[model samples]
Target: MTRARTSLLPYLLLAPSLLFLAALFLVPLLQTIGLSLTENGELSPANYQRMVGDLNFVPSLRNTFVLVLVVVPAQVVFALAMATMLQKLRLGRDIVLWIWTIPLGVSDLAAGLVWLAILQDRGYLNSALMALGVIDGPTPWLTYETPVALFFSVVAAEVWRATAIVLVILVAGLQLIPREYAEAAEVFGARPWTIFRRITLPLLRPSLQTALILRTVLAFEVFAVVYAIGGRNFPVLVGEAFVWQTDNQNTGVAAAYAMLVVVISLASTVFYLRALRTPPEQQP
Candidate 1:
């Protein structure tokens, strides 16, 4: 009786959470999948076919991939540098981290708007450039004709807004790392770079895995910021989905696009899980 009750206890405790997950995530996911796989009251791949055939589909897919490729690596590098600085800081670490994490409280739309104010032709960036005699007039960066500029503008906003999440994860991960390992490495005359490359990074793998999975998923789902900053100038996967749903009144196609996003995100998560697989013996 005791053993039976003990085994039941864990599942009993998990029941509510499992129910919640099913209600919130699994249910919606099944619905989306069904929607994506059906059209006109019949089971068909029509929606996906329409989605892929859409004029904006290829551009949106390419831009989303480009944005993810640029933004994810940049954010990881920036967050790692910021986390390293925090770990070494002897003064105002909390204040600096608090300042660095200010972006965390900002919503996607709001962050995009914030950068919009800075990067718009007549916005702060152009104004500052003009003030410094770098430009004679306001510069149009977020425009279709300036594809390179438009791309970088979106990338910058994304990096600024999302890097803080990675930083927080890494900071927590770094905190968990015992300082003695680094100290012992130092005693053995290990260079700081060598210590980080071997000790800190190996210990931080779990956190890196988590950060990559999360950021990669979000990168695929990038929308509002691109919409806000580049508008229709820069097409992204989620943006095209929005256009299909609201602008074109095609819920089926939108659902198809969404399913594609989910599929890509799942693949990326699986890749990270396998690539960053930490053996039980290496678990920190």
Candidate 2:
């Protein structure tokens, strides 16, 4: 009875947080899913069928997949490189880390605006190219109806804004790794590349896996950058969902879109976890 009471105490103490999550997250999510599967106060499969045939819905899914696929890897690699370099440098590390994290403080909307200014016609990029005689005239950046250009602009904005987050996670993970392992590898005449490939990367996998899953999940829901740069014509998943809810006043469809976002995020997270499963020896 005493042991049972002890266990119950912890759960009782945790009851508020669990209830809060259920109220705010789980309940709303279940409600959204219910909404997507119903129409006109009736349980109908029309929502799912419509999403399959809808032009915008399919494209939004594709755009989200592309955005996450490109941005997650790009952001992780850039963050890893930055973290590795930062870890190696002995002097001014504090200052550089502070500078790197400055971007995290900048709002996504603000970052998009900053990049829009630089990439616009007659903007700094064009001005510099012209001054260097690299181009004859101002080049159209946001004007051309190219998906690649649209994606690149979105990626550039997101990377600038979110790279610091990944850097911080990686740096913290690196700190957790004992110095003795690296020293041991060095004493055994292990080259830098070998040490990194075998020791550093293996030890950092848990953190990297976490960062990748988080960034990928966030990337799928990206809105501000595409909205600011590509506008409505080149909409991603979240932006399209917003349009469906606000512009079209289609709550059912919007809920369907929201459910799609949740599905995509959950799928990506599962894939990452499966792919990054630790070896038995490394398992906690």
Candidate 3:
């Protein structure tokens, strides 16, 4: 009876968390899936077909992919560098990290608005350029004629806003690494890059995998930042979902878009799991 209670205790302790997940996530997800499959109070795939055939669908899909491809790698590299710097800092380390992570407190929409103010015509960037005699007038930095520039602006905002998340994760991972391994490598005259490449990176793989999976999934769901900066000028998957639900009043198609985002997010997660597979020897 004692052994039975011991075995049951673990499940009892976990029961609350399991129930919370079911109520908060699992139930809503099931509802969304159900909504995606129904149209006009009947079962149908028309919602999905409508989502696929929408005029903005291809462009939104492409832009989302482009942003993810451009932003995720840049954030990874930047976050890793910042994490390494934080690890090496001996003084004012907390201050620097606090400053760096300020953006983590800022919402996606707020970050976008902040950047929009800078990139808009007659905004700070143009004001600075004009003061420098770089241009006679404010340039149309976020204009429809300059779609590439607008795309880049969204990418830049996303990187600045989201890199902090990745940085925090990598910093925690770096802290877990024993300093002895790095010091031992240095004793053998391993170059800075060599130590990082061989010792630090190999051990940081698990953290890297976690960070990548999270950031990539968020990238696919990016909406507010793009909307704030580019509006309908830069359509994206989430934006389309918003339009279908709010503007078009089509809950079925909106659910389809949501499901599509989930599918892409799942697919990317699977890809990262495979690509960043830790060997049995490296498993923690």
Please give the CA lDDT of all the candidate structures. Answer: 0.94, 0.85, 0.95
Q: In model 2, what is the error at residue 225, expressed in angstroms?
A: 1.1
26-71: candidate 1 lDDT, tens digit per residue = 9999999988998888999999889888888999999999899999
TM accuracy, model 3: 0.97
TM-score of each: 0.97, 0.93, 0.97
Distance from true location, Cα of 218 in model 3, Å = 0.9
Query: In candidate 3, what are the lDDT values of residues 49-86, reduced to their tens digit?
Result: 99999999999999999999999999999999999999
Candidate 2, residue 194: the lDDT equals 97
lDDT per residue as tens, model 2, 73-117:
888889999999998899999999999899988877788888888
What C-alpha lDDT, on a 0 to 100 scale, does residue 139 get in candidate 1?
92
Q: Between 2 and 3, whose lDDT is larger?
A: 3
Model 2 root mean square deviation, Cα atoms: 1.8
Error of 2 at 175 (Å): 0.5
The TM-score ranking, best first, is 1, 3, 2
Between prediction 1 and prediction 2, the one with superior TM-score is: 1
Q: What lDDT score goes with residue 280 in model 1?
A: 98
Q: Model 1, which residues run further than 4 Å from truth?
A: none
